[model samples]
Target: MFSFFESQRLLFYYLGFLAFALAVLTKGIAGLFFGPVILIYALINKKLIGLLKNPHTYISFLGMAVLVLGYYFGREALNPGYLEIVSFNELGGRFEENLGSKKFGYWYHLEGFKNYRFAPWLLLALLALPLAYYSKDDKLRKLTTLSTLAVLVHFFVISSSSTKQPWYDLPMYPFLAMLASIPLWILYSALQKVNLYSFALSGKIIAFLLLVVVFRAPYQEVWDATYKPSEPPWNYETMGSEHFLFNVLYGKDNLDKAKVLHLGNNDHLRFYKKVLAQKGIEVELIEPENLQSGDVIVTCQAEIQSLLNENYRLELLNDSSVYRKYRILSANRKSPIDHR
Candidate 1:
């Protein structure tokens, strides 16, 4: 949308403003990247002077401010203490989560790029940086520079945080794809000049095959090994050791806006909290000793027998080898606590 505005599309400028506002509503601080992306785009286009004078640019900033305040106040209205919880969870809680985990902070992405996971796709995109830097075409050079700079800016900002996750970088994917396509088309055009049909077709086929080998094969292998027929919604046991129950509770269960009594450690608890929130359901983590009647227990496989012995009618919700989800059918049903 910012690109559209840069190209003098007035309608898209407003649309982009609305789009970024919606993004802010959905993802909070994550959606604020458009401000920097637009600044970088204007800088690359040498229109920073005009940028300062543009009424539409100021409107964009106004729209963003409105969105930020509206989202903050709206959450406060909804829960009163929501922002306090958000601050603690987003900052202190997240920092604690990263204490011992060694999954690269913000630089994990660089490792993926360097490892050639996507090979020519990644390599081609990277090659565009230098090509764009040295290109004679003004428009192409500015756009590519904007893409590169936007990605770098996003990376630098996100990396400053102690916590990093794969999904956090989604905003950067489009720019990376844009960068990769530059060299890709350049190579195709070069091949076209060398051999209009024969070599071009062969090169295309080879490139396609290489992508299949480098990118698709590993993903397909993992999918085939984990996917299950009975569990139509989710692949069993593939969602981490602690997430199996979480997956079934949020994925397969049909209870409308159901509340979940989670009997487990706090590991991956936030993910389930978010998922349940989307479903308009509440999730509470409770101790095993505090178990009550009619309270469904979501726990690892080892706890199933103990739950059964406590006279809770066990309805197996998930039965994967790694983890399980079970429901306690009757609060009134009484039997031996250790019949198992």
Candidate 2:
């Protein structure tokens, strides 16, 4: 499994840096998703399918997969900057985020902090437990159970964000998917030797999972958010090639510019600005305190008024909060804050 680990090393570093930076800056452990990300890193490097064939190859492949997949998945698209726009504009709603993380790590936060949005992640992790414990293959069982618990805890904790930002859970998805895949692969391998009854059952179960993965609802927001280049098409500058968030939102191009205040890694807002600048529109990256009326200030629900001057009006943009209050609010300069 040295090869697997070899591949995941970069991923680990990339995610590690991201988690550390986010934790320090956000004053929260929204970075907890990194643990699952690491677990997935271990699995991918080891090469799940290959390791299953020969337990000896397990460790190496696990390492490799984690590295490979982690590198691939650890893009800026998964960060809070893109996630906020993407979550509201596309993908699942804020119901799944753990608010507790807003104040601290998910577990350390208050009660009922985590809400909806557990798309079989917890179930799959839990299911893998018994399989790993009972597996005929000792090596696989240990890895499976270990990985399963990692993902389960990751999901349970990260989901508690009082402020549910989509990217907060980004680190866990790859690990969750990989962890779930292992048990099925093991089950199939085992059933191949057993009678057709169990084999058929395994087949059915695997097929069902395939359906869940494949047929899940599309992120219409993203598809609809796609737009082509023009005299900057619309007026504002949109950085970043291919709207990761936009794609998840409209499922196509909406072709509009957001005067966003981005607070993320590598200055995510700044990252997008470079690209949009190419298109002739320089996007502004401001902090909440820099928030101004009439300007579309994009930030977490909690941070909205943190930068607000109270002179402008709050319009509904998106609401992914624990209380499910105002998620994405717009401060309109047209009307008085008190009047509206």
Candidate 3:
């Protein structure tokens, strides 16, 4: 995008359109903001008329349409109603109603900046905006305008939607980082003007130290999140147990022939099913009454005791905090020893 802004070559325009199409393909309609952002920037800079007169712009748009719409057309051809399902379930449904009860106010993303992850850079970005806007440099002003537009456009669009996730705010970070660099650059330039050798050296040292101070918190956050993640507050042991169970069964003998029954409500059942399917394993949801000899049951702790009370002899295979894996040794028969 920066390259396109610097050079209005037809090749750059094509590359930009291709990139826009790829972004949309990768993340769905969230990527459509690219067009509106560029259009708005051109209008703000009084370049709309010029862009309209440029023939290559239309050619680029046509190419992008073929690339993006072709995929949608092929998908719809293969599975009729695919686009309709996506329109309702993945696109418009998110805006019209809260899916999965993930409702949050419009200020959710805006408030997220106050969190530890973004707070440090966000402050610098905010301070840099005014300085960048009033600067005499033409290129700096344009870059700042573009970054600001991208941030605002993406922020409002996602924030207004009923369905929200933390990752939805990811697209805004690059632009915010771009904006944040302006203030750092200004400080570096100011420090370079110190007249005395000692003062200049001291100023450079101070600037370097300030840069380190500003980056320390976010860097540590990245390190901890990647290498030494702390446990989430929510109870995720059941889900973790499912993953552990799958890992244990992944290479076991006759896994493909095993009748695996998942009991109780598990929200990620579909995802886990797909993952297991790739490993030649099939899992089904079954009730406690459906227990049969030789059947394997993956259930939570709440259901284990009741199965045992029903006179089903279950052999414990593995256990996690809230989930258990068991094989039915005998169904509708009492065992001499308590299995629980």
Candidate 4:
């Protein structure tokens, strides 16, 4: 980012600084590396002290420091244990627990590289780096080399972490795209040299082909969206089936006046509560054993048999391979005998 904006207008330099601040705010520690990344770029360009002496650099750092420190203090003030968790428990053993093991950290990142089912694309993108670094074009070589270096740094940092997820590599996509385009440039140059057509016409064709290759996945996705049935709203981002469950309810009943309850974690319950809150409908999450008279509970098929023995009425609402939605009737507290 700094490289792109360094030689631009004065406004662009400040804009670059703002971009760095925003990155840190949104991405946390991942974005913090931008500070060192830019500094290294300055050193590579033989402007190390020149960058440090620049007032904009200091302003950017000051802004980010204030934002981060203020957030820390605010969180600590709100919850006394927040500081302790942030300092020790937040990422300490948490990643290992979530990831299951640290041995596959590098493999997990490699697997994530083919997120869109295009493994070869990433391999080709990597191959472009050396070519870009050694190119005859001074501007292209320098910019590509810098971008590739930044991506490598990001990759190593993220891969070293105990936790991993596919979208964690999003920051490297732009550099990958730039690197991927090297082959097209080479193809274009070869075509122009062959004199098959005017240089201008050949260049236009190559540009169009490059764009087509770049946008192929989007084109395929658009086609799928046009013809495919509406898919279940199972989002990995939230790691929940709340949206699908809600939509199932939406089809058969009015949520505004419905009695709703969920049997799950606080995070999942919060999703249900937020959706039902404005309508003055309170959704309660109850223990399976504490099944009371007139209690409505949401649970899956696996627990239905156990609930049945306790005299809870079950109505199947929606069924999926992974999760089955059911409306559990209240337990008959008057009699200990099973109704089913």
Top model by TM-score, which number? 3
- Cα lDDT listed for each candidate: 0.64, 0.47, 0.73, 0.60
Give each model a TM-score: 0.60, 0.34, 0.72, 0.67
Model 4 scores worst on lDDT over the 10 consecutive residues at: 253-262
In candidate 4, what are the lDDT values of residues 22-82, reduced to their tens digit?
7655765566654666667777878788767878778866876787778878888998888
Q: Please report how far candidate 2 places residue 52 from its true position, in Å.
A: 29
Error of 4 at 59 (Å): 4.5
Badly placed stretches (over 4 Å) of model 3 are: 195-203, 235-239, 242-340
Q: Lowest summed-lDDT stretch of 10 residues in model 3? A: 252-261
Ranking by lDDT: 3, 1, 4, 2
Best by lDDT: 3
Provide the clashing-pair count of each candidate structure. 1, 67, 0, 0
Over 4 Å off, model 2: 1-101, 104-117, 148-175, 190-340
In model 3, state the lDDT of residue 272: 61
For candidate 2, lDDT tens digit of each residue in 115-210? 434444455555776777777776666566555555566666545434544455555556556666666676556544544554656655665565
